[model samples]
Target: MASVTYDRTSCVYPGAERPAVDELDLQVEDGEFLVLVGPSGCGKSTSLRMLAGLEDVTEGRILIGDRDVTGVPPKDRDIAMVFQNYALYPHMTVADNMGFALKIAGLNKSEISSRVHEAATLLDLEPYLDRKPKALSGGQRQRVAMGRAIVRQPQVFCMDEPLSNLDAKLRVQTRTQIAQLQRRLGVTTVYVTHDQVEAMTMGDRVCVLKDGLLMQVGKPRELYDRPSNVFVAGFIGSPAMNLFTLPVVDGGVAFGDVVHPVARDVLGRAGNSSVVLGVRPEDLELAEHGPAVEVDVVEELGADAYVYGRTKLGDGEHQITARVDGRRPPGKGEVLHVAPRAGHVHLFDVGTGERLGG
Candidate 1:
């Protein structure tokens, strides 16, 4: 296992007006599972490709365990990559596929067989050792791809959306398996995906990126609880946080008829008559007198329900979402009053979209 470092690393493709991965600086601890996540065209994949030595570092250096490898070739980087499509050779049996790297490295047949069997057992693919890739299910093929990397014992693992090919249910199951497998192997891993839930659940620390720039890196809960900006506030959560610009009045921002109190410093930082207020769906409650909203839809999820509504705040209408008890959700078109829980509101500068305070 080894630590990886990106020292102001950057990648600019030919003729591109801007860098695909801008001067990114990140440190991955030994044996840590770090996930790079963002929307499509956000440079997450380009960053991963840079680490794998597939893309050139245009402005800075990358280090693996104190060794500067910015100019190293892909095969010489001592890293294993699991592609999104599970690039397995169709004609090769599972055992052969897993041990192919070792065979190429000139390891004897006996040693390669031993290593292949060990990885298969760890991945629960021992029964399918003789089967070809065409005979395996998507999930099974993914595991075979994983076993291929495991058998090599590479210093770092680079997995680029390895679960994108699986069904939803299998994707969830395989993510759990991969997380556990990474923990057991203790290999430094960098995973790239567009799914925030997968990043939150599988990574020891998640890195959020946008437009080739790093947004924030933190534990899943930290990112969800205290986003650094409005973009992050709306991007990290399921159903997302409801954000709307409201007039600042009496040291607070208006929420319909009521003024929600905010820190004086936060209000001062706004430097404007209005500020954006963000509230998570689960952090809101039905109140007798609060923001009046016309319900558009209610999604009932067994123990909890989310109410999507539109409310006229200030001079314009804005959409709002709130979580309510699942047992009794208000009917469509029903008017409901909801308020964000005290001390749970997020304040952002309307002009800059930056967070004001905690």
Candidate 2:
């Protein structure tokens, strides 16, 4: 396996004012599973396509290990891609589909057969080797796609939202399988998806991007615990972080009648009269007295529940979300006091959105 690098690489579609993938510089260590995540219209997929040689680089270079492969053909890049649609041949059996790459590369029938069987066994698709794509379940078809990638034994694997077609339960299951299999094979892999939860669970490191620019790159917990900016703070969590641009007061920012305390040194760095305060849903808890929140909806999810409500913070009312015990959630229209847990608040510059303080 080889490490992958994007050295200030960029891609611009003709006639477009801005680049699809702006200058991106990233390093994926050998055998590392790196995930690129962002919202729709973000450049995650374009960056992947540039590496796969399907898109032209308007500037800079891409490297696989020590080799510069910016202009290399896709077939010569020593990479395999698993697309979201499970691009399998309708007429081909699972075995043939898995071995097709080997056969095309001029491997003998015996070699191709051996490799196919090995991959199928690893993916638990041996029983369906003779079955066509149409006969397989969605998860089974995905396995076949994976088996096809595995048999090639490429230096790097590129998967573009490979599990998007599956149902929610199967998506979770297949992602686990894929992560385990990637670890077992020890091949460098780069995966692209719009799902932050999937990226958090599957990737060794995740790259968050927006509008062709890299936002943050870190281990899942790092990004979750210490986001670099407001965008990341708001995006990385399942129930997105609640952000309020409130007036900076003597002790802290104003949250209606309450004050969410902040270190003087932290507020000093804001450079503005107001600061953006972020708090995750889990960080906000029902308290005896804090900001009064009128509960609007409660989403009960067995062990936990999310309470979405409106509260007065600063000069106006705004929405807030809090995670509470599912069995004891407050009903709609119920007024409850919700406060940010100690040391759980995130502060950012009101204008620039950059993080402030430790």
Candidate 3:
């Protein structure tokens, strides 16, 4: 097992005006499952490639454990990469595919067979050892790819959106399997995905990036509960947080007719007449008196539902979403009053879009 480090590492493609991956300093603790997540073109993939030795570091260095491997070739990095496409050889059987790296390293047949069987058993692919890649299901094929990586017993694992190609149900199932496997193997892994849910559920810690800059890094709950900025506040959650720029009055921001009280120091740090108020849908309730939300649509999710509506706060009408009992949602075009639950509201600076206080 080994830890991975990005010591101000950067990657700038040729003719690019800006670096694809900025000087990102991050550390993946030994035997930790760290996920790199962001929207498309956010440099999550580039960061993973840099650590895998596939992309060159335009500046600074990368480390695997204590070894500086910035200039090292991909093969010499002692890392195993599981790609999105399930890069399995069509002509080879499952056993052969799993042991191919060992063969390249000149390990004898007996040892290679042992390792292949062990990995196949762990992945429940032992029954299809003699089957070719074409004969396996998509999930099975991905397992074979995982098995290939596992057989090598490398110092670190780099998985680049390995679940992108699977069906939604299979994706969920496979993700659970992979998380369990990683815990059992205890290998330091850096997984890249654009899916926040994947990053939230799988990683020991998640690193969120935007436009190649690190946004926030934290445990799933920490990032969800206390995002460092407005971008992360809106990005990490499923329904996303409802944010509005409201006039600061009486040490609080206006929620229409109501004054959503905030700490004086919290609003003081922002130093602005307007502060951004953020409340998650789940954090809101259908109250008797608060802000008036004109109901637009209600999304039913069996046990609960989300109310997507609009409200006029200050300048113009703004969108608001609130979670409510699925069986008792207000009708369309109806007006409903909602209030944010105490201690659940998030405040941010209007100008910088940064979080205002703790």
Candidate 3 structure quality by residue, lDDT tens digits, 192-279: 9999999999999999999889999999999999999999999998898998888989968788788888888898888689988899
TM-score of each: 0.98, 0.97, 0.98
Q: Write the per-residue lDDT of candidate 2 for residues 262-313, one digit (tens) a residue.
A: 8999999988999998999999877887889999999999999999999988
User: Model 1: per-residue lDDT, tens digit, 123-175?
Assistant: 99999999999999999999999999999999999999999999999999999
- How far out, in Å, is residue 103 in model 1? 1.4
Q: How many backbone clashes does candidate 1 have?
A: 0
The TM-score between candidate 3 and the true structure equals 0.98
Worst 10 residues of 1 by lDDT: 349-358
RMSD of each: 1.1, 1.2, 1.0
Candidate 3: residue 130 Cα off by (Å): 1.7
- Please state the error at residue 338 of candidate 2 in Å: 1.4
